[model samples]
Each structure stands twice: as structure tokens, then as C-alpha cells.
Target: MSATFAGPITRSPHPASSASDRIHRLDIRDLDELSPDTTESHGEEGLTMRNQKEIRETSIRSARKLNIRELRALLGRCGMSVSDYDIEYVAALHGADGQPAYGASPHDGCGRPLPGNRGRPLILLSDLALADLETAVVTIYHEIAHHRSYRSVGHAGTEAAAERYGWRMYSEFVRQSA
Candidate 1:
């Protein structure tokens, strides 16, 4: 049960423009900003966990944890292939060190298509969403919408688009249980 604070994610001069799938999307993770001093136990599995700056906090708690592999499969069912993006479980989403203006809302979750990387885009999901499968699914949909729109919230019709896309997916997968 040890907790530590860290820094922020630095953006390179230019984001990667690969040919593969053009990785890009939002990744919602658990809540780390809410629990900064909280401690978690990993026993002997060596599972690392935390929620702070410029760092990615990983957790082994599967209570409702969303599996990345499963996430891709779910996306397939949703009529999208996010193979171009990389999704990871995180406690909080951080902005570029000194670039708060370009930072994202540490709320539900966030998706980024350009973070200066060579591989697929990065999606920072809230690890807290792991507490519920439906929440995770819906969150994915929301972020997927952002990816599809190629823009995070704050733009015109961006948030609406994410909501529509996200709920549609949720209804298709959860409500309908398809």
C-alpha cells in the first residue's frame, strides 16, 4: 500500500504519423486525482498502482477491470478498429508539463491521437471505470467518438457526437445485450 506522486507527459515537437492505422483515440481510466494519498496492495504479484502526473498507473484489480484485448474486440463489434491506437489503464490523465492550456480534462477519461510517439495513438482510460463493465464500455464509446471525430471535447458538436456514438454502442452492447 504505497503511493507516490509523479510528473507529466511531455509532447514531442511532432506527433507520430505512422502508416499502420494512424493510431488515435481517447482512453478513460480510473480516478487517481480523487485518490492521491490512497494506498493499494498488490501482494506478491508485483502489480504497480498509483495516480499522479506524467505517469501511467497500472492496476491488477479485476473487480471490473476492462481488458485491453477485450476492448479491441468490443470495438470490432461497434464497427471500428482501434488497432491503430494503444489503450492503457491509468489513474489520471496528465497534460504536457508546462502546457496546461493544451491539457485535457481529468474527468471521466481522455483520448489522444497525437502524443509524439512512433506507435499507435494513446488512450488514457480511468482505472476507476474498471469498477463497472457497463461504465467501461460506455466510456470506451465516448472516447471512440472523440477518436472518430478526431477531436476531444470543447469543440462544436464534439461532445454531442461522443455521446451519441457512445450511447449507441452501449445500447447495442449493453441494453440490447447483443
Candidate 2:
């Protein structure tokens, strides 16, 4: 989806609710208009230093739009054949029923089955779940784990597995690139 914006790029780091997900084109001219909680966290005073650090480090990459080629390299690091799947960024995703939702997946990622792709080994990332970089990485791994788990452990289990697995992949990528 094509959009025009000025200034530092950003969107809410939270999930999109149904009521606010209808806009096809967003006018993003200012960070103040998008994030009211930019300067402070909800309450970081009591958390451990590591926990606080993790929160800060794990923030969505709002300052820059993440590169898709970089993410494809991430998929390659995770062992998915880059050319086999059709991966692209989207502004908002459609519902499961395929209705138009302009910005429904700001903080979510999805993995979908492509049985007709001439023989894919497993499910791949839901092309829709990638509203941002953090969302893309997490969702890609989550979907990979989710589909590979054979529907036994469910979403939460898949999420846990994805964090563990995706972290290793990301860490390895950083190490190798360095």
C-alpha cells in the first residue's frame, strides 16, 4: 500500500482496535499526534534493570521503516527458502473472511498455509502480520513455530517457542554479520 508521510515515521506500538482500523490512508506528519506515551513508559521505576532494558530494546522500530530485504535474510537465517514464499509488507490486513481492513494489524503477525504453492514444506508467515519490523520478526517465527507444532500446544505455546527460537536466529544473524 502506498502512503505519504513527513517527519520521523511512526505508528502506535499497540494493537489496532476495530473502530480505528478503517482509515485507508493515514496522514502521519507528527510523532506527537501518534504517540502520547513517547517520553515515558507506564511505570519503569520498579522493574529490574535487565527487564527495563529489554522493554526499551524491544520497542517497535518507529523511527524507520524496516527493510524487507533484511527480513528476507532473517527468514533465510531461520531456514526458510526465500524465493519459495511471497512475502510483502502491508498497511492493514484483511479479515479472515477477506473483507477490507485498512490498518487492522499494527501489532500482530500471521502465518498462513500455502498448499497450492507447488509443495511448500511448512506454513509461512502470514503476509499480513507484518505491520512493523518487530511485528514481522516475532510473527514470522511465531507462525513458523505455530505451524510446525502440529496444532498441539496452541498460540501461547507457539509464542513462547517463537521468542526462544527467533532470538537465537536474530542473535546469530548479528554475530555472523559482525
Candidate 3:
């Protein structure tokens, strides 16, 4: 004798909710914007006001429009891969010593080195700072400037040479590769 198999059927719940069961849905951004506190911390790790400001200032044609994946891919295309180790090293070399201390800045995406002896090395980057692809390249190039300096000398420079050299190297690399 042959036996027939039966499968469990799933059903959707009723579409309507009772007066006592009202529910609300919201995106993180909407929640953030609605909160009284302008800055929100995610557990111990979160973006800071200073970091947000830095991204804002360097914002050129494509600022606050780059995603992290796009930034990573762009760096890979440029032959520079930034891993956790490299990120920490670069952040530290740029003056962000270690995990941020109490009263210290939270995010360190300023494109500039952390303040000497009083900053963190995590260097957080959030969607608010980089929303899509083009800005990722710009942000990565800025970070590369610091990394190259760390590799050559002990740390990244803060003088006019730093910015000049960083932009110069970035331009040269792009032109030659293209």
C-alpha cells in the first residue's frame, strides 16, 4: 500500500488590529530624528559630533553619499585593502591612541589625525557620514593619505605637507592607474 504525505499549511493573521493592539513601525533614521537627543549611542560604540563635523567639512562633490561596501571595493580597485588591523594602525598613527576614554570624542572620521594623546583609535564611519559610492572614494583617499604617512614615517603629518602630499599622491595614483 502507498501512503500519501501531507504538509502543514501556513495562514496569515487577520489584517485588522483591535483598539487595544495598535502597533507602530519605524526606521532607525526616523527614530533617531525624532529623539530629543541629537546624538545617539549604540551601546558603547557610536558616532560622535566631531566625527560628523569632519565629514561635513571635507564633503566635496560626493560627500555623505557613500556606503562602506562601496568604500571597500573602491580601495580594493585602487590596490589598497583596509582590514581591521590596518584601520586600527592608521587610526592610531593619526593620533587616535586607543578606545576612547570618558569625555573623549567618539567617532574619528575627520580625515585628519586624532588629537595627540587624548583621542580614540576606533574611527567610526556611519551611513549619515557616507550615504553611497562616490563619497566612499573621497573618504578612502583621505584615509590613505594618513596610512601612507604611517608606513613611511612614524606618523601622519599635520602641516601643509600632509594635505598637499595626500592630494598629490591620490591624484598621481589615479592618473597613472587610469
Model 3: residues with Cα > 4 Å off, grouped in runs: 1-64, 84-135, 147-152
2 against 3, candidate with superior TM-score: 2
> lDDT tens digits, residues 41-155, model 2?
2121110000011123344334565556777876566444344434444553433233322221111122223332345423233333343655555444433432333232211
Error of 3 at 144 (Å): 3.7
lDDT of each: 0.40, 0.33, 0.32
**Candidate 1 C-alpha lDDT tens digits along 50-69:** 12232223423546566767
For candidate 3, give the lDDT of residue 9.
13
Clashing pairs in 2: 109-129, 110-126, 111-126
lDDT ranking, high to low:
1, 2, 3
What local lDDT score does residue 122 receive in model 3, on the 0 to 100 scale?
Answer: 34
Candidate 1 residue spans exceeding 4 A from truth? 1-64, 74-81, 94-112, 115-118, 151-157, 175-177
In candidate 3 the C-alpha lDDT for residue 169 amounts to 37
lDDT value for model 3: 0.32
Candidate 3 per-residue lDDT over residues 1-178, each given as its tens digit: 1111111111122223223321122223222323222222211222222122122333333443444555556656755454431222122111122221111122233323343233423333434325444323333434443343333443332222222332343453354347
Q: What are the TM-scores, per candidate, against the unseen true structure?
A: 0.44, 0.37, 0.34
